[model samples]
Each structure stands twice: as C-alpha cells, then as structure tokens.
Target chain A: MVEQSEQYLLTAYRETGNLQLLGRLYEPYMPLVYGLCFKYYKDEAKSEDAVMQIFESLVAKLRVHEVSNFKSWLYTLARNHCLMDLRTESRVSTVDIEEHLVESDRLLHQQYEEPITEERLALMESCLEELNEEQQRCIRLFYLEQKCYKDVAAITGYDLNKVKSYIQNGKRNLKICMERKQE
Target chain B: MNNNYLIIRIQRYLNGELSREEMYELEREALDDPLLQDAIDGYRLQQRVSHRQLSLLQQRLADRITQQTKERHAFYFGWQRLGVAATACVLMVLVLVLLWMRNHPDPQRGEKEVQVELAVPQAVGIQALPITGMAFDAEPAQGWKAFNAYLAEHMGNELPKGEVLLAFTIDEQGRPAAIRDTEGAVAELLAEAKRLLDNGPTWKGNTGKIKLIFR
Candidate 1:
C-alpha cells in the first residue's frame, strides 16, 4: 500500500512538475538519506547538507531515470554521491582510493547463504521470544516486516540509534540462545 | 568474548564502516559458517532503519523553499503597486494643468479687433461744466447728435476716411485723458472729439483703452 502511494506520488510529480509532490515523496525517506550521509561524512552539519543536496539533485535526476523501487534506488544513489564526495576529500587524508575500491569489490562479491532449515528456523523463533521487549519489537519490525530502521523507529517510538542498538543486541542474544538450545 | 567481537564486526560490516581487510575476513568467515551467515542477514536488517531525529532536516529545507517563494511574490507585488501609483500621479498632474490653463487665459490670444464699450451721457446744453467727484450719473439729459455735430464743425474735413483707431483713458474725474490716434492725421480730431464728449457728460466707471474706429 505504501509502495503504491509512493509510485502514485512519483508519477504525479513527473506529470505536474510540482515540487510539493516531490517533497511528499521524499519526506518519508529523509531520515534514511540523512543516516546514510551521517555514516559517510560522520559530521552532523555535513550530513544535513548532504541530505538537502541529494534532494536538490534528485529533482533533475528522477525525471530521467526509470526507477523501479524508489527506496533502494535512492539508497544506492545517495551512497554513491557520498562515496564520490569522500573520495574527493580523501586526497587530503591518508585514506587511498584503492582501499575504497577494494571495500566496494568485497561488498559486491559477497553472496547470501541458503535459507535456514525448518528445525533451525523454529529454534530461531523460540530464541526471538527470549529477547527484551524493545529488542523483540525492533527485530520483528526490521527483520520480519522488512521495515527500514527509520520506519521501525517511527513505529516503535524509539530513537534511530537506539533502534539500531536494539536490533544488533537482539540478533546477538537470539544467536546465543539458539546455540544453547542446539547444545 | 570472541563471539561478541564477531557480532560487533558483523554490525560494522553491514554499516559499510568495516575496513577493507576486516570486510574480506568477514566474508570468508561467513562463507564457512551457515550460522554466521544468518547473523549477517540479521545485521543487514538493522542497517535499514532511518531515525526520527532527521525529520528536523526536512523541516528546515521546506521552510527555506517557502520563504524564498514568499519573498519573490512580495517583490513582484511591490513593483505592481508602484507602477499603479506612478500612473495615477501622472494623470492627476495632467488634469490640474488643464484646469489651470482653462481658468487663467492669455489676453492677447485669438481675436485681434479690440473693442471697449462705455456709458456716455448725452449733451443737455452746449456748455462745459467742472466735474466735482469721480462718481456721476451716466444717463444723458439730452442727445449724442449735438455733441458729434460740434466736434465735426471744429475739426472740419481733416477727419480721415476708411478707419481711424483712437486710444484714450477716462480719468478718475470723468474727464478723457491720454487721447491719441495710431494714424497721426486723426490725432488732433480725436483730441477735439474727446473734449466734446467729456463736456457732454460725466463718465462713471473704468474706460480702459477705448478704441474709437471712425470709418
């Protein structure tokens, strides 16, 4: 339902050339863009600037590119823009372009494993129940419902960083719990 | 302790914060262990959340755009008002100038033939009387023919034909003064005529540049 509404807004913005429509389309995902920028730049001001700059660029770019999934596409585009900016700035720092390329290559080459067996999946589910209330909610919303961290935070009313911490801590606890059950 | 460190490394790897070597080691480790791969999948889920704090960024951008739009509209409206006011002032000034021109006219403009009409009394008896004051009765006691006949007899046939323009002023004592003709031939005749006319009656009001055109 949300995806359909986003698609409708994207189409309306393209047809009408109304920035307000574009603004509505981008507003929900502003946190994701800012978070991604913060991860790259690490400076609060630079991250904020990057989020605004990404939207400005999106106005011209979204018109040309045929995007299927706006969220994933926007994520990749924002990451690329930040990576490029970091690459340019890295000339002044000790970080080399070769290291960035190697990291990108490693991420690209990484493959996913087969789905967990039915018995292991059952064990994981029971282990999930052992987590704290906040962790349980954050894990269910993020891993099962497939909501982004920002959406999870919005639904759970947790801070963005707190949501990430909960999910991370919960995942570790669930793994430990599952291992003990196997032993 | 090793498992805790590994979990931290997996989280960092999902965030793209892992160093190139650490990332390569993690990828190799995950490939060897199916349980570690599941943990990697869980870590990837945590990376997707966008926090509530960044909504402030969106608000600020929206405000800036709205402010710029308002300022542009105000600038355009200001110019529009100024243009309207300037046009009204120009029209008002034009109307005032037209009214002023209509009220105060040029005396020497258009008509060249100047005529001055006055109330002259008729001669009662052929005798000159001493004028007492500036004010007197303008109604004639007798007739104008006798006064004109007396002037013709004194000037004889020296009065020119065609048109003779005589200019003079009636003094405060109701006596003719500064009697002169533009044609020098009728100057003496005009003086005699003025004297006879003055004797016939007392002039009461202003007789300014009286033109006597004798044709």
Candidate 2:
C-alpha cells in the first residue's frame, strides 16, 4: 500500500527526471538512514554528512538499478556504503555490530498474523520453563506482561543491559527447544 | 504503516515514551526483521534522531533542486535574449537603409550632363568650356544654369588657353569664399578662373567643383 506510493514516485521521477519527486520519495527514509549511519560513524556530524551523501548517491543509483524492494535495497545500500567507507579508513573494528544483531537463520520470518496452534503453544510453554531463572523472569515480564526492557530491568532488579541479554538468550533457547520438540 | 509514523514510533521507543503496547508491538516485529533489529540497537546507542536535523537536510535538498532549475532557466533565456537583440539590430539597419534609399535615390548612377550649348561660346577663335559640378553626387544643384550664364557673359577676349580646375566651398553668406586653382594652372589663367568664380552667382547652399576649358 505505502510501497505503491513509493513506486509511483520512483516511476514519476524516472520518467520526468524530476529531482523534487526523488526528494519526496527519499524524505521519509531520512531518519532511518540517519540512524543507520549514526550506528556506523558514531558521530552526529559525520552521520548527518553520510545521510546527505547517501542521498546524493541514490539520485544516480536508483536510475540504473532495478529496485523492486526499495526499503531493503536502500538499507543494504546505506550499510554497504558505510562499511566500505569504514574499510577505506582501515577501521575494521567498527564492523563488529553483526554479532550483536540477529543472525540470518535465527530470525523468525513467519507472518505475524499466522495462527498459533495448541500444540505449538504447549511446546512454547514447555520450552519457556527450560530457560534459566533470570532469562525466564526477563522474558515473561518483557513479553507476556508487556513491560518495556527498562521496566523489566527495574522490576527484576537486574542491570538494564543484563535484562536485555537475558531476554535475548531466553528467546533463542526457546526457539531451539521448540524446534527440537517438533522434530 | 506510514514511514513517518514508524519513525515517530522508533523515536518514542528510544526516548522511552512508555506506550508499553507500542513497545511490545515494535519488539515483536523486530524479531522477524534483522534490519529493524539492527536499527533499534543502533538507535539505542545513538539515543535519538532530531526532527530538526532531518528538516534541515530536506531544505538543503529542495534548495539544490531549485538552484539547478534556476540556472537551466537562466541559460535558456540568456541565449533567447541574445537572439532577440541580434534580430532587432538587423531590423534597425534594414529600416535605416530603406529610409536612406527613399531620401536619396541612386544619384542618377552617373554624372549629370551639363548644357554646353548655353555656356560654350560660338566665336571663331574662342569656344565655350563644359562646366561640371560636384553636387550631382548627392543632389542636383538648381543654380548650375545661372552659373553657366554668368561664366558665358563674363568671357573676355583675353581668355586663358588651358584647363584650370577650381575647388571652392560655399561660405555662410551664400557665396564662394575659398576659390583656388587646384591644377597649378599658369598665373594668368589661375587669376582669371578665380575672378570668374569668386564673382559668380551665389548658390543657396552647395560646395561645387567646375573645370574650366579655355580655348
């Protein structure tokens, strides 16, 4: 739905060669791009500069590239541009963010609207209990009780970072256990 | 959801705008999307993205587009103006040439033939000289006939025997003032030609040259 408008703008810009149309298309993603750049550069000024630079590149790139998924394509473009820039500066250490993010296989790509069966629910409950005490507490509070990470940390008397890790580890363990049970 | 709405949610989440349901919703979705998860982690480290900076960047983009358009328009119109000026110059020259042609036709293309029968003497020893005037280059002078009659009437028996070219300009008083022999005629012939022209009839306003042939 929203993607249709983005595609319309892209088509309009390509046909008319209108920069304003491209600007309108790119404007909505500026914040996301800025945030991604901030993650890499870690400096407000540099990140802002990178955002504008990415936009400058996109003006030329979008014309030639067959971009079907604009959001993900732009994300990949921003990330690779930042990574290459860092590599040119010999700062390989900054690319250490990969492990902190979800690995490809661990991501649950299932649709949110998919129905949950009783068998899966029971399996998930059993997997939930197998986690260690802190993981269980953080996961239950953060997800089941609808508490934010900070609130879960405060309620559970753990460090905020500790609470985040516990919930992450707990979710990974739950997925592992659920897969094992299904097999 | 709209991209702006999603960005606002991300900002609120980072700022701990504790709409717990929204937080849960964002977290649940982030589970399936690695890009969103990474962005969330990045936002956590960076804190927040200011709307002010985003707007400033947008304004800069808009200004760049407008400035490029203005330069293109200026370039296109600059050539157009030069073309218009060149055409106007050509038109004005054409009109002046037309007006000039109407005021002065082709000067009869050749010299006007002076009536020699009136000026030349019919005597056996002396013959009348043809009088030529310079005014025929632009406008034919009306006083050439009168001047020819004056030259014929003033012919004394002691006429010079060679050609004497006299150049003179008409003075403000409507009379020839600077009458001088240009061809270095003999002293007597130069004096006689000068006398004949200095006392010749007045022209309203004309500078003329008349060649005198004495027989």
Which runs in model 2 stand beyond 4 Å of their true positions?
A14-17, A93-95, A100-113, A129-134, A169-183, B5-12, B29-40, B67-215
Could you give candidate 1's per-residue lDDT for residues B22-49 as a string of tens digits?
6656754543333354335433544543
TM-score of chain B of 1: 0.29
Question: DockQ (Cα-based) per candidate?
Answer: 0.06, 0.28
How many angstroms is residue B154 displaced in model 1 relative to the true structure, after the best TM-score fit?
79
- Assess candidate 1 and give its TM-score to the true structure: 0.34
TM-score of each: 0.34, 0.54
lDDT over C-alpha atoms for residue A27 of model 2: 81
Query: What is the lDDT for B41 in model 1?
Result: 46
Tens digit of per-residue lDDT, candidate 2, span B15-75: 8784867787887776655557666766777876577977887787778678768978999
